[model samples]
Target: MKMKVESVNLTDPSLLLRPEPVYDGKPVSAFRNFDDDENDPMKARVRKTYYDMHTNMSVDFVKAKMAKWLKFNHFKATMKEALIKLNDLVDESDPDIDLPNIVHAFQTAERIRDEHPDEDWFQLIGLIHDVGKVMAFYGEPQWCVVGDTFALGCKWGPSIVYGDDSFRDNPDTHNPKYNTKYGMYEPNCGLENLLMSWGHDEYLYRVLVHNKAKFPKKALHMIRYHSFYPWHAGGDYQHLLKEGDEEIKQAVLEFNKYDLYTKSAGIPDVEALWPYYESLIEKYIPGVLEW
Candidate 1:
């Protein structure tokens, strides 16, 4: 059956009496911690996926990926239609919740909306944050499309999750050009010049820019680096920051709260929330867009 998108009325008195969405007060560490051996086999799957991502996502790999994906010829899709495609993506690299990816999208967006009600574009950014994972449905491996992203051309910092041992076998680890502290990039060159590990975050960021979506640069940063746990979460890669990197870093940090801490087993009424998001998508990214 086709998924139903229901419109909800927020001003209804009876609905107001219902409890707001529960947040459970979980710390970010409790969210994506994949080291728990006692956890389900899914954790093992997540571990292996990150291993592959860390090993193969070198600078050249990123450049090749950008060349292939940035062409924007994959397909044309409306924003909502592209987002709905995430229903089929179960990220093997995330140790967090295992529900349909779209549910996580709605959950993240709703949490942002709860606090920043007036920032509709920010809320819309939250909703479609992972929409580029649609590449998974198009036959890309989960390793390339999901998982935490990191700077590819530069040194893989020790702060990267599993960075110490996981990337040892990667060819770039020993390459003279790519193994240094500042591989292939200048000091304080800014993040825009860096080639990040190829993933949904970079893909979606490029998509928004390519389609000329009217989101703020801050929202674009949130989309681009939401998975760069090393920089935003682990405090690595500071040597490469340019003049205003601090402000963009702060924006990513703020968005991270809603993205990570708000994940819950509970699902959102996607249908009830669709109308509001549909309006936002129309305002920012209307009609079919190049992928």
Candidate 2:
């Protein structure tokens, strides 16, 4: 599955350190509802999805999933091909947009492009961020691939969506070693060392690292933890932070503004936009990649 990738010029340090954009129109805060709204018809499905995830995503499950996917033996396709395949995946776990996931891919990328035109790598990361949800297309269920990820081996923070009511049946909730606040990990153990619930975020992060993609640390952190609503959004899990997470946390929050707000019912013209994104992909992660 290996193919040679030409070296893409890295981002200029000046562009990487640009100040955050001033968002126009409505604030992104309007869309941050993680709890079930009694009037919203999608509540039942969303609740059930979280219930399944919280009930089954234990330390053992995370370990087994890491072993399975970290092998990277699933299949091979270029970044464009993988992004197209996402059109077939409708994330039942997402309460936002019910349209094909490809629309959100372009929406997120386009939003970034509009605001941070100088950060081409950042825009590309937006398009491919959810490409890891392709795991569902390969036989993994929606719950396993699309839900918000949390640290599996630690205490489930109150910030997790439905964290209080859903994990009652989970075995880890009763395990003496894992039931406590610190669980199996020590305080201030950086997120890189903890096992997160298996999902698209972790999958795509690993894929980029294994293939030696040219993304920097900020891009890597955003890819791995975009769905970590509990930490980035809820302001929980500060107790688990290591020394330098302050900067990474800021980047994740900035990225979240685009990821959450850009989702819409409008679909992008995939064929027309293909050329520009293809060039960007070639520049960064060229050739067929391991699935």
Candidate 3:
């Protein structure tokens, strides 16, 4: 049976506490499955997105993208204005949800609010975490703007969705400086020191800093590494971690639960929720932001 959105009890404390929450009638383990099935359109779409991402996401490519986007010269808009624009985007790399990205944004924020009622900054983080995806409107493709992020100039994590098979076509796979386990990084250099692949995660984190958003450091950390599945979720890159990095991993894990499992949650009344979230936006990330 299809799980109706209304069936989820967002207020149930137990629901918030469960380690393996159910979504759309599937067990949590069933989520994030990257198995190939050419006959399945959703699966095929996801595979193609990752294949393209792996094929082209080289060190030089990521550097060039950073040069293009990090200038913050793109159009300026308030956080709310940027979020509303997501109503037109459907992430091609997501196999789970087909709804406009805006719906997922509210679903994530609302769930975080329910669980961490006092942490307004965390709730705001949830609301705006994907706002960097507004890059899609400026001609960036979904493959680079959405989906999971991994570190560049290092061996690809075995836990990355499609594993080595998907990255076979990438030129970096053959490059001596990038394909090794440690690659260009020294031992214990820490997560922040690594050059992560260019994506919304890095883009929005920089934007928040550049605009002087007042969110706490932990909130900024959550937003920055939430999509770094290989490091946070897959136990990769341990040799590169420094002291206190475990706390960062735990923080990302706490935020990631809502991000991944809330996709099938009930469609929020965004119109009704905006006033509350707007207060949050005003508090932490007010004003027209340079994209």
Candidate 4:
């Protein structure tokens, strides 16, 4: 189901989902390789839109949104329990493989760790890469947890698994001003100038940043771009990029090759790696992550 039409239909209204582009056009079942589907062609013309950096938001307004969400009881569970629960999301949207969510995340992270054994921080990134999926276990819909990252800029990626096109059925896409190619931004702005949909990549990145952790810039790039398949892999939207963004794009593409093409069932046991990581965390994070 990696075909464009199918990938374009990830959030079928019939399934209560909207159209999005979270794949190379593959489908998943109890048994199927998530990787290659012989006939799927994901390399068509580029899709419009990308994540934005600056929001049209004011400090108080941003604070108000955070305050509203902060009022909710997001979670109250141990990391292990949360990890177990996180797998329950079982992305019906992701068709390539049927591995449980944690298993899928482990597959991505573990491969990253094995090939670059010297990069311990990437090992942690591999292990906890999808920690944002915690939101799935916390009662957010798949649309909320697993979509594209974007800024306050207009017309973000529609292929994000957890979001629906109905999200685009609003005035934003049609409004004459926001409908322009750049929306709320000037041309060639860097990602640092954008704001994305609130999700796990940023969540984990914030944890590392605020605590002054030692995650590599590459690891940080992983957190940010694992979901940004279009620009990195598809070569879309380069017209809006700045001078050096291409180099950043190249590095992200190098990292993405590892992320997409590598997966194995023969890796070392994740359970075996946990004890060492637990110590690493004790030294790195606050008492524990919130959810």
Query: Number of the top candidate by TM-score?
Result: 3
Task: Give the Cα error of residue 176 in candidate 2, in Å.
Answer: 1.6
Pitting candidate 1 against candidate 4, the one with the higher lDDT is 1
TM-score for candidate 2, please give it. 0.88
Cα deviation in Å at residue 198, candidate 2? 0.5
Best by lDDT: 3
- Model 1: per-residue Cα lDDT at residue 214: 93
CA lDDT of every candidate: 0.81, 0.80, 0.84, 0.50
TM-score of each: 0.90, 0.88, 0.92, 0.66
Candidate ranking (lDDT, best to worst): 3, 1, 2, 4
Q: For model 3, how does the per-residue alpha-carbon lDDT over 206-286 read when each residue is reduced to its tens digit?
A: 999989999999888999998887777667799999999999877887888888888884799999999999999999889
**TM-score for candidate 3, residues paired by index:** 0.92
Per-residue accuracy of model 1 over 1-291 as CA lDDT, tens digit each: 111111111121212232244347543335556563634688678778978887888878888888999999999999999998888778888777788889999998998899999999989988999898999877788999998888876678666766557888888988989888889889988877777899999999999999999988899999998888777666677888888888887788778777776678778999999999999999999999999
lDDT of 4 by residue, 1-291 (tens): 332332333322211121233233432121122233455432111111111211222223334434534443455543445556656655433443345667765676666667888766666666666666676555554544553444434554444322333335444555655556677778878765555555566655654564466666766777776666435533445546788776666556555544444333444466876676666455544254443
Per-residue alpha-carbon lDDT of candidate 2 for residues 219-248, written as tens digits (9 for 90 to 100): 999999888877765666787889988788
lDDT for predicted candidate 2 compared with the true structure? 0.80
Looking at candidate 3, the ten consecutive residues that score lowest on lDDT are 1-10
